[model samples]
Target: MAKLALLVATFALAFLVVNASIYRSGHSSCERQIRQEDNLRHCQKYLEEECSDSPYNRPGRYLDSCCQQLENLERECRCEGLQHAVRQQLEEGEWEREEARELFQVAKTILRKCPNFEEPRRCEMQSRRWF
Candidate 1:
């Protein structure tokens, strides 16, 4: 379920770059959540393509990008952000739940690859694995 959460979170917060990550919307929390979810559905495919490193070290440095994208989040909020991105991507792609779990595991395995990555333990995605 890690990949699912990764994909979903990555796409869900496509707004990560669009200013929503730090957005102070006048809308209610519920409305904002819905909007984030919708954005995930609409943009997960592109985000995955741009944010993934699998299928041969993606060109855009998706992990670095993800790190940067999530950097501004509070410590506890980091995993939540990841989960949202993964979930969006997974949901949009119709991938299996197991993929999400594996992706999370894969992510943990490769954590050292991102020297500067600072995702806290909550982002461990221990409940999932990655390719």
Candidate 2:
């Protein structure tokens, strides 16, 4: 009976360790997601407030305050956030097809011009469609 109790206690300890590890990992993942979301929000606000006025129709001027904004964002995270914003605008009819495409091009340019920015390998602009 003593041996059986020892065996049961060993199994319970192992189970508790595994459960604790899983909980910690899950919590960290949640925290990382929240941080990414906050970063995305900051990028979006910067784009709207500082970049919108410049418009991409002209050269050089487009990057004015935009480069500063992109510089502050996580490279891959900002790419994902920009793609999401463009798609959301297109789907919701908040922007015309041409305007959305222009916005995307502007984002790409900002990523290219910003110092230390690395373009995401998997980031692809959505295909243009006629409305």
Candidate 3:
């Protein structure tokens, strides 16, 4: 009778151990998912901030670096649908062309304001000259 009682206790302990491990693994996975989601949100917010007053929000140019940053952010995000959509938009050649035009306009504006806007070259998106 005592031996049977010991066997039951042993089985219960083993079951509890296995259950605890599974719970820990699942809990870690949930935490990771939450972190990834947060990262995606942060990246989106950054994109919004960078484009807010820039030519990227206007009709002509695509903020080349901004677009590239979005791509990188998307890659780092690793959340399926969000990453895919961003990748698609950034990769579109037409979209790049539009971005280049907008950037050119922005650079032109900066050059006017600071005559020595030494960084105009960086804003030059060479995808295609709309002129």
Among these predictions, the greatest lDDT belongs to: 2
Q: Any residue pairs clashing in model 2, and if so which?
A: none
Off by over 4 Å in 3: 39-131
Q: Each prediction's TM-score against the native?
A: 0.44, 0.41, 0.31
Better of 2 and 3 by lDDT: 2
Estimate the TM-score for candidate 2.
Answer: 0.41
lDDT at residue 54 of model 2 (Cα atoms): 40
| Each model's lDDT | 0.50, 0.54, 0.42
Encode model 3's per-residue lDDT on 4-103: one tens digit a residue. Answer: 9999999999999999999888656644553445433433333333334545454323334333333443222323323333333344434444453443
Please estimate how well model 2 matches the true structure, expressed as its whole-model Cα lDDT: 0.54
Measured by TM-score, the strongest candidate is 1
Candidate 1, which segments miss by more than 4 Å at Cα?
A: 1-60, 107-114, 117-131
Q: Candidates sorted by TM-score, descending order?
A: 1, 2, 3
**What C-alpha lDDT does candidate 1 achieve relative to the native structure?**
0.50
**RMSD of model 2 against the true structure:** 8.2
